[model samples]
Target chain A: SQELEQSPQSLIVQEGKNLTINCTSSKTLYGLYWYKQKYGEGLIFLMMLQKGGEEKSHEKITAKLDEKKQQSSLHITASQPSHAGIYLCGAGRGGGADGLTFGKGTHLIIQP
Target chain B: GAGVSQSPSNKVTEKGKDVELRCDPISGHTALYWYRQSLGQGLEFLIYFQGNSAPDKSGLPSDRFSAERTGGSVSTLTIQRTQQEDSAVYLCASSLWAQGEQYFGPGTRLTVT
Candidate 1:
């Protein structure tokens, strides 16, 4: 079974400060996806990275996949209260047909 | 275009009762997936359906849990003799094909007392 280990299970940061969350996969990641979730709500897609050493950014959120494709990182620059939520990194094993293995998630709390 | 949708946003049932949750995928989407999310936990893949291929049920926890997709569009997950451990948010997602981004539904919050 594939596993994704996320770092800093929970984080609290002051508004305007930057934060980074990492997800390390036990297997080579065929595809890496980032999502955000508010309490009791469905996850909102953030970004997806496939190629090794590839990086993608949307608004203040940026995600990167290393050359090894075994790890991915999500970074938030100049975070705001709206950025506070649970961030999840999902790793696809092979193709879109395969189920994604998800990390436990990083709980981000942004203080105003 | 509308996103995936699930019915009965919230459900509360007693232990030993059977519960059924429904999911309606976006029109034209050929793949649908069901997942379970425990309180403060990651997603647990329950089942998946892609076009006409045999459903990948490897993620189903046990025989008590089963799911079926009708005409490759809507899906229903049935839990027989539900236990307290079955309490979780059931999420549904759909994608245009097997290897692409998936849109998700609000999810059905099932609480077994």
Candidate 2:
């Protein structure tokens, strides 16, 4: 089974500051997904990275998959209160039909 | 268009009782998934359904857990003789294809007391 470990299990950052969350996998990553979840709510898809060295960005958030495909990072620029939540990283190996293994998630706290 | 919908947003059941959680995927989606998230824990894969193919039940935690997708649309996850450990949020997701991006539903919060 593949395992994903996220660094800085919990983080507190000032609004408008930049922060980065890291996800490391125990095995080669075939598909990496980033999602955000508000307290007690469902997860919202943020981005998906498949190829090694792939990077994708949406608005103030950017995600990058390392060339080794064993680690990924999510960086937030000029964070806001809305960014405060749980950020989770999920990985899938082989085919897409396979269920994803997820990290425990990083709890982000943005202080205004 | 609707993403995914789940019934009984919150359910409270007693130990030794059975519970059923329903999930309605997006229209025309061929892939549906069930995941459980316990407090302070990450999402755990429960099952996967793609088109008419047999569901992938590999992720099920135990034989007490089972699910069914009727007409390849709606899915129901049944937990028999629920225990306190069964308390968690059950989320449903759907994607246009097996490899496509998945959209999740609000999830059903089950609390077994």
Candidate 3:
């Protein structure tokens, strides 16, 4: 079974600061997905990275998959209060039908 | 298009009782999954249903947990003789394919006393 370990169980940053959250997998990643969740709400898909060395960005958030596909990072540039939430990384192996293995998630708080 | 939806946004049960959580996947989705999230913890994969194929139950925490998909659309997860530890949010997700991006429902918060 694949396991994902996320760094910095939680993060607090001042508004307009930059932050990064990392997700490391125990097995080779066939696909990596980033999602944001407001407390008590369903997760919202952020980005998905498949190919090794692939990077995808939406708005102020960017995600990159390592060449080895064993690790990925989510970077938020000029973060704002809206970016405050739990950032979760989900890793998948093989086909799309397989269930993903997820990390514990990083709780991000933006200070005004 | 409507995304995945779960019934009874919140549930409170007593230990030794049984509970059922329902999930309605998006129309035409070929894959559905169930996951549990303990307070302040990450998601734990519970089971998966893909089309009419046998579901993957390897992630089920114990035999007391069981699930069935009806007509390949709605899924129900039943926890028999629930324990206090069973308190958590049960989330349901669906995707066009198993490996594609999954859409998640708001989830049912189950609190066992």
Which has the greatest DockQ?
A: 3
Report the C-alpha lDDT of model 1 over B1-113, residue by residue, as the tens digit.
88889989999999999999999999999999899999665698888899988999988989999999988889999999999999999999998988788788999999999
Which pairs clash in model 1? A96-B98, A96-B99
Instruction: Compose the digit string of candidate 3's lDDT tens values, residues A1-112.
Output: 7789998999999999999999999887888999899999988989999999999989999999994749999999999999999999997744444788899999999999
Q: Compose the digit string of candidate 3's lDDT tens values, residues B2-111.
A: 88999889999999999999999999999999999997657988899999999999889999999999999999999999999999999999999878899999999999
DockQ metric, candidate 2: 0.78
As for candidate 2, its clashing pairs are: none
Which residue runs of candidate 2 sit more than 4 Å off their true CA positions? A93-97
Local accuracy of candidate 2 as per-residue lDDT tens digits, A1-112:
8889999899999999999999999987888999999998898999999899899999999999994848999999999999999999998844444778889999999999
> Fraction of the real A/B interface contacts present in each candidate?
0.56, 0.77, 0.87
Worst 10 residues of 2 chain B by lDDT: B38-47
Off by over 4 Å in 3: A93-97
The whole-model C-alpha lDDT of candidate 2 against the native structure comes to 0.92
Give i-RMS (Å) per prediction: 1.1, 1.1, 1.0
Model 2 TM: 0.96
TM-score of chain B of 1: 0.97
lDDT of 1 at B73: 87
TM-score of each: 0.96, 0.96, 0.95
